[model samples]
Target: MSVIKELARIINEGVNTIQSKCDASGKPFPSLDEPYTPESDAVRIQVIADALPIIAAANQLIATLQIPAMSIIVASGYVHVSAAFATIAKANVVEALREAGPQGLHVKEIVEKIKKPMDPAKLARMLRICATYHIFREVAPDVFTNNRISSLLDKGKPLKEILAKPLEAFDESPGCAAFVDILIDESFKAAAVTQDHLMDPSTAFSDEPNQLPIQRAMHTNKALFEWYDEPGNELRRRRFNIAMKESVKFEVPGAILQGFDWGALPKGSKVVDVGGGIGGTTMALYDIHKHLRYVIQDREAVIKQAQQVWQTERPEALENDTLALQPHNFFEKQPVKDASVFLLRTVIHDWSDRYARTILTHLRAAAAPYTQLVLVDQVAPLACSEDGISDVPGATAPTAPPPLLPNFGLAGSMVYNLDIQMILLCGGEERTVLKISQLLSSAGWKLQRIARVPGNLLHKIIATPA
Candidate 1:
């Protein structure tokens, strides 16, 4: 069959699966016109899984059908849409629209509600571009309302509250807004300078975190995290912290449970959460397996923040010694010498292999003979089939059926997009399983098994002392 025909068949199959699931559950198949909601139904979950290949096939079909030059031009012009998205999000347009209700508001009313100095015409244009991409909806000329995608950017705060304290705009947000803000502001800036950084002789061959495109773009000598610490960057730092916590929402609910079994450890066994920001993972684990003791480690600032959080959320854990927040750099010697498990959630992909190895070596040096290392990060896949590498035990790499890109094209683009984001922002790259295995081996750990979190792109790589 022709590629287009195959893609249409895939879409038909997926639509049928969705309809069947929705019909069985007696729930609608969710409309883009409505606001977003958390899906917990078994049928809803299955529908998402069924839809992945269809989305991939559809995107590939569009690319296949479009003229090569026009396709490239369209892709290149997406930066403008990204800028428009950031503008609307940063201006708190979503909150304004939410206040205006489903009837929507004119661009003039939106600007007035936001109490910003934005021009109504310019703002309308920005919203129009996003609406063209199916983010927001234009019910009438110069009037708009929040659709499912646009509503997700709502920070859930009153317009007045957000406007009163711009810096604290994301304080009560679910992290999506903050994540979008940071991605467009800093990550986007870094991406813009990536080619220049790569071509510059000073940083071309450099793997140092300080040599990242972000440093060059920001004209700072400090690494990305260090740059966030400088005075006057408080908002950036706060948003980043919030964004990290919000990232877990993208994973399957209870994805932490899908990985290595924390319940299997003996009661009161030590679980070191390396570079754990605000102890989110540890808190999640504590909720399920209260018998385990967790030591959440990070920079002093983050540890302080984690302490504040734990004090408010789980003071009993601190009082009973079930949880402890320790300020320790992973590159330095690990102080947790008897940990049964070292959990590194979304940590490894933020640094180059050289730095990642150093962090792991420190953990290995401090680990007990039977200690296990669990790495929660994306294992990037190649666009084509068979990424020429030996597989680790328990690792699964599923290829797509013929007529679609092996990695499922745009369905799996997040990992690849994040790979470049890491490179530009932190001199890191998302590794394939083989690369991860090799890095672990160099750091005195053997890759034991890999488990992909259901409904998420992240993988749990469990390793042991070599």
Candidate 2:
């Protein structure tokens, strides 16, 4: 059979496996609105694993089998990539129509309701594009409504919330909005000139914060945090906090809770949330492991805010001193010494090799001989070899089945994008398990274990003092 035909057969088999798994459990196939829950999520994971081969094979087959016209369309994807951000900026349009409900609104009516006036003709093209991408529904010409995906982008729920309020009431609770803003405001501009940074020897070789692509692109020597802390950057800092809070959704903090044997630690053991913002991840885990005492540490500004969060959401833990908020910077020596665990979620990836080493070194200094340091972030697969193994040190990544890309291909798209985000925004890059192990060793720690969070992209790099 031809390659396409074979791919089709593979897809059919994968679909059958998925359907069979669902049927055996006697549950409806998961929907976008109501996906598989914790109790019923295992089958979904299995089904996806079963289908990875078919899906990746289909992707490769389709690309290889494309006609000249289709290849040209692929060649012009840069336009589409550029336009995607433009479309996100036009999120207000989607929000206005979403407020109008599923019935949607006429182009002219939506044009007026939005904060900024948009031309009806131009709005039509935007809506048409969104509709083409299955974001909005064009039930009839010029009337658009929200579908499953667009609803997530609606105001107050996600990106729209932070963007809607750029300055006021800004103490960093917003997430999706702030993150989207970061992408549009700083990262996008820097991404456009990334090649320029690479080609320039000074900028390319330098991992110093002020010398990176983003610094050059924006014509500033301030590093990302430095820029956020500058005078007149209150709004920027607040949005960053909001974005960090929202990151809990993506980081899969629950994985750390379940992935680790927290119960193994003695009751009332300490867990220092290094660089914790608002104690969000700690709060989640605290709910499950109530026996442990926790300290949420960060810079003074956010530590103050985190106390307020603890007071409001978890007053008992705060009142009883079971959960404490401390103002401590990770760059300095850790203050809560000899803690049972040091948890840094989405922190290490934000720094370069030298910086990451420093952060680890500081943690190592404060850590007791028995203390475990948890580095929670994405563990990038350095490369996928023909054998389907990742070239990572001190650990192993899950191998994809035959006919599947070694690292799950499109399913791993966000990982690849985030790896670049590390470089574009900061002079950092995601590391393989091996790289992480090397870093840990240099910081006077040994790689103990790697824990995977089910249904999430983040990994737990557990280490101990050497």
Candidate 3:
């Protein structure tokens, strides 16, 4: 069944479970038989409202799963769907051919290299399919050359490794919604059944595990935070961390670091990277300003990973007088009493407005009057382009769609889409510049300045206490 259809099915199961419980307790059940009635109407409405979170969460997990599934599907053609010949050629076969160059592999050699043995007829069929997909050039009959798609694979980028790294985390899809489904349902029940008393965090989340050392202090959830920290839960941790890292790597954080003048800071002045994961950005920054002092604050797991990576790859940076790694919980309060700059990169986006404000409020309270706050994030454009029709009569181009990368020009859109994904999975979101300004302003922060980073895909939103 389609993933969407399966999502609908899973959601209905949640609704039915709620209905069954209501019926058992003598609450009037929504009539499955009756299409619309005042008596059943209220119950049906309640069920949907309660089920939205689960439904959303389920859909997100399903989407993440599709990446790997689709990658695999593209590599190995199914019965009905044609292979992703173009993508495969660029990503896989081309790489092998580039290595061999003019002296291309024989059919048997190619099969052995790809590690999957196929009968002569099947090999012929695959080569034919690949030709249609532009994966293999017909250099000679029964012999082929790697196309662009296949070339990418030869560059040490394996389909499975590349695909798996980002999504290995977060395995529970819509099907597993029942686990957290009941908790969220109970939250609604608690709010409705009791007065404001049950709504209190202290009471509702009493049994909840301690918030994650850094990020969790800002938000709390037992199942999720623990799952994020668990060593055995490598897939969830790696994928989740990488997804967060990707936001920094591709655009905002890198740009912010690159565009801003790092060397201007006082040599001894410290910059605290609150919630910095594995010091990926920190390393990037250090590479730029080797003399600047950097303090990386994160949970033990993430901190340990960061330190290990630093020790192994950038041991010189760690050994020098320039950097220090520290663990911190931003929620309890920041550890740095004072610093030249407090860099909270992409930390605020993973929160509700209220929680985000609290985090900013804490930062504001902690900062010295002259301290600069650098919020590395994507500041959305003020307006989208209008169609050419407005400018001239009968413009032929019909508003040429935004320019894109060769294979997919919509890479920027994909980055923004991560905002929506964050919202669905963890109640976090990417923010527009205006939304960020409003949030920072509310927390007594004044927008000092905003500038796009150079040669990279992000911006630096500098703010300070009002």
Candidate 4:
């Protein structure tokens, strides 16, 4: 068969496979344009995994055969500054438009409401770019309104403490807001000078967190978290912290319960959420397996907020002593000893190997022989599908069908993009299965299994003592 025919056949087969999987599971495919509760379709978790290679193979062929130059133009267009307009609007326009709601607002009216008046035309142009990206809507030629996507910025009405002011209302998408804010404010600045950071002889060998692109961009010797949360940078700190929960870059917190075998522990046992922010994931876990107790440990600020969250949201659990919020810097020591499990979600990926080792070592010190360390992070797959590598004894995901990049390239972009994010933000990166196995081995743990949460960008790695 001709190459075009072969490509078409492969793409068609992928579509059929995906549809069959969805039909068997009786769930709709996940969407970017519409909101769907992932928990609603628990059985269809593997559909995306099965569909990724198919999607990648077809997309690769399309890029190779059809409109190669046009594909480049479109891809480049996507990477451009439309996100900048979203950030600006979130700061300037979104709050102002809250009362206006979906009825719509004229650019002149929007300008009148602005704290700092800019030309209406300039604001309109900004909105136009934002609309092109589907963040806001352009109902008419010049008129605009909020869509579901943009409506997330609206956080209900303001309280009497600050009447009618939108910013005081709090953010509805704190996670998303943080993700965007960091991507724009911190990550972009660091990413722009990446080659400079890498190529500089001074920085080349430095795995020290201080020697990072983020450091160069902010002109601070302090680490990203320290500098970001310092005196006047409260807004920056708050946003990034919120982003971790909201953004998987995309509850990521709650979804993890699916992958974690919470019920396996004996009744009256404890689980320690090390570096757990707000105890959201722990809460999710507790909700499912009510028999177990959870200790949520994080920085003082996070623990303070968590106290209110537990008191307000899970007062019953707090009363029963089922959930406890404790202030801890995991780097210092594991205050909670011999717990059934130590859960680390998105923790190890944020630091360099040396620092990561420190975190594991702390856990190792606290761990009893039977205690399990559950790593809730991505297990990076190979980029070239055909290149076979020996799998660690137990960790696994669905194998991609032929012709797709082993890692599913753009389909599994969360893993790859975060790899870059780690390098730019801190001196860390994601690990391959082998690297993860080695890391666990060095930390004195053995890989047991990887439990993948359906539709979740991250998965849980269950391990025990070596």
Candidate 5:
């Protein structure tokens, strides 16, 4: 197959795998887990294990490009080799070494064994370059062996479904093509020119730092609810929505439901889901606290889509009067009077601190005395090591100590990956506990408590207006 075809194929497969696993794992989304023992057939796992380094290399390249430019770089070789080489995934080098085994293998042998039908000369050159990074041990000039990082490529480690799908899926999607093209263009510009100048806002790039190419491909054309507004844009809208859904499948809102303590609310109190997308979190919360009156507030267009989903999937579950779909632009004042609980999920992160403060300030004013303000997003844990252990008490703890604990791998993967995504997308940052506390305090809310839920994948910072 052609290089772009192969590249797209791999990209889609990796993303799909990540998404599917997130759904299966029952967290807010899919998370990567470590492999142990032998499960499934060894050969298939070996293929994944073998593919790790190559994928890592690809991701490294992908990461270097602005999010918008990634797809284009792969499709058209739109990226410069120098930039691509710089962005290669360190994980790839490590995996390649792990595959070297005890005796190690010559570059030629490694390529033929792992990828098969290899050109000996090309393989030799790639291996030599990889050796420079200590991805493998250079036993002989052209031979290599596994090292600490390479060992992680072992089979059974959780990979997301989005990353594991067949190439045809990506090849079939026009949005994917557009997204890739723009991503590449943006990546080239960023890699060659922009990031360094970003520290100073005086630079031209700062005018729209977040408007990178990927944002154009994903949000501008496809948009979250633009289809509902324009009849001809239905396909784009639906496709965009699916991409958003796929992107966040593993980020299960239900996990937040688990962390939340409903008993703290007054018995007959009301909770409103402001700007709640698709009612995923609303449904999850409803399941958790059946007694709390739940209302959903979003744009009329989105609410139509959400109500339809609820009616088809959960007609009987949601009480007729309890859950009402209302239209309200959060930038304007809130319409609801005397709410006991005001909940915003994945909403606050979309704006700058100034605008974010405006939204929170409005909610704070609307809140009655003793009201709870629940702001839920992927609150990044304080920086921790690969072990997922943090010195802070309320941070995500390993379900059990490392080496034996499945939870350790799960928490580590999600926190690390999401942190990277948040930084790139919109300057919507994931905060540590201290950062979050300060944000809330400045917004006229106080963090009364934080609750961490196991297996669900989220922590609830229950607060009240100060």
Candidate 6:
């Protein structure tokens, strides 16, 4: 079959599958016109095992059919889209529209509700561009309403509450809004100077965290995390903490249970979450396997925040010593020598191989003979098909059928985008499985297996002492 025909067939099959599933559940497939809710069944169905290929194929078809010049132009202009999104999200336009109801409200009314001064005409144009991309709905000439995509920015607070405490706007959010804000604000600024950072002799060849594009952009010598903890960056630090917790929303429900068997561990086995920001991973694990003891290690400030969270969410865990929030840096020697499992979720990718290996080696030194190390991060695949490194003992990544780029092209672009974002913010890069295996091996750990966290690009890599 021709490329276009094949793409159409894949999309058709996917739509049928989705419709049939929804019908079986006695609920209609969700409409873009409706506002988003986390409890909606639509999210669950979309992330099931079978829906991934269809989603990839559909995205690839659009990219394949678009005029090449137009596609590039549109891609280049995404900065504007992000900027507009940040503006609306920050100004609480989503909350305003939520109050206005489905009929929508005039752009002027939205501005008035937000209590922020913005030109109505300019705001309309911003919403219009976003609407063209299906983010919001331009119900009338200068009126806008929240749609499925736009409503995801709602922080679940009243307009007055959000406006009165602008700094605390994202506290009640699901993290999407904060994530978008960070991407467009700091990440965007850092990404803009990527070319300059890459070409400058002083920084081009450096792998030091302090020499990253963010440093150049923000004129700071401190590394990204250090910079966030600076006195003047309190708001950014809080938003980042919220965004990190929100990262789990991208995963399928019960994703942490997919790979390694937590039940197999001996009763009361200690699980050390290294560099675990605010104990998100540990909290997820504790929810399922309260039989196990948990220790969450991070910077001192983050540990304090994690303490606050535990006080509110699970005070008993703290009181009973079932979960401990310890302020420890992974770059230093591991402190929990008796840990049965060392969990690194989205941690290793924040550093280059040299730094990553160092962190892993510390854990290796502290690990008991039977300690299992679980590294949860994105395993980037090549754009074309080829047998991966033979030395690793895990299933290779699946490739797409003919005409689609082997890595599923734009459908699988999140990992790539994150790779660049890592580079821009810190001297880090997303690694291929082979690279990860090598890093593990250098740290005296053997790659045991790899498992996908269904619905997302993240992989659970299990390793053990070499």
Top model number, lDDT: 1
User: Candidate 6, clashing residue pairs?
Assistant: none
What residue runs in model 1 are displaced by over 4 Å at the alpha carbon?
39-43, 387-391
lDDT of each: 0.86, 0.73, 0.54, 0.71, 0.53, 0.85
Q: What TM-score against the true fold does each predicted structure earn? A: 0.97, 0.87, 0.53, 0.84, 0.52, 0.96
| Model 3 Cα lDDT, one tens digit per residue, 1-466 | 6656555565577667877867776667643322223344445444543444344535444554678878577545532112333223322344345555655656665655554445544565566675665545556666666654333223244434433543422222211122222222222232233333335465433322233222233233443435567655565464444444434433423454554677898777788888787676777788778677888888777777677767877888778757788877676687687877888777777666777787788888888987888877654432244332222222211111212121112224443554543333334567765577689889888876666543233457787779
In model 2, state the lDDT of residue 119. Answer: 71
Model 2: per-residue Cα lDDT over 1-466, one tens digit each: 7667776777788788888888887875655432113444445555655766666777767776789688788656745644653554544665576567767888888767764555787778876775676666787788877665555544343335645664742343335545666776677778888899989877778878777778878788898877877778777676677677667754443566766789899998999998888777888788888999999888888877677767877899987789888888788877878699999988888888899899999999988888999888888874364321243333677765545567767666677788888888877777877678888899999888787765477878888899
Going through the candidates in order, what is the number of backbone clashes in each?
0, 5, 20, 1, 43, 0
Residue 334 error, candidate 2, Å: 1.6
**How do the residues 315-340 of candidate 6 rate in per-residue lDDT, one tens digit apiece?**
99999999989999888999899999
Comparing 4 and 6 by TM-score, which wins? 6
lDDT, candidate 1, residue 6?
A: 88
Please identify model 2 stretches exceeding 4 Å from their true place.
24-27, 30-48, 68-91, 157-177, 251-253, 386-394
Over the stretch 1-466, how does candidate 1's per-residue lDDT look in tens digits? 8878989999899888889878887888778898877862345565667878888999998998999999999899999999999889888899999989999999999988888899999999999999999999999999999998898898989999888888888874887888888888998888888888899999899999999888988999999888888998989987887777777776677888886777889988999999888877788889899989999998887777678778988899999989988989889999889999999988999999999999999999998998999999998887776644445655657777878889888988999988988888888889988898899999999998888765688888999999
TM-score of 3: 0.53
Where is model 5 more than 4 Å wrong at Cα? 1-254, 317-319, 382-413
Which runs in model 4 stand beyond 4 Å of their true positions?
1-58, 65-79, 92-103, 113-116, 147-174, 247-254, 386-396
What ordering of candidates by lDDT runs from best to worst? 1, 6, 2, 4, 3, 5
* Candidate that beats the other on TM-score, 2 or 4, i.e. the better one: 2
Cα deviation at 126, candidate 5, in Å, is 18
Candidate 6: worst-modelled 10 consecutive residues by lDDT: 41-50
Model 5 agreement with the true structure over 1-466: per-residue lDDT tens digits: 6544554565567656755654565432211222122232222222332234335435434444446665665544523332333232212322344444567777665555444455666555555554454444557777766543333233211222213442222222312222322233333434344353444455324323344333443344322233235675543444333333232333333465556677677766899888775576677667667777888887777677677767876786555566777877887898877788898877776554665777888898888896788877655644333333244345444332212123233324566554544334443456666677777788899777666754333567678989
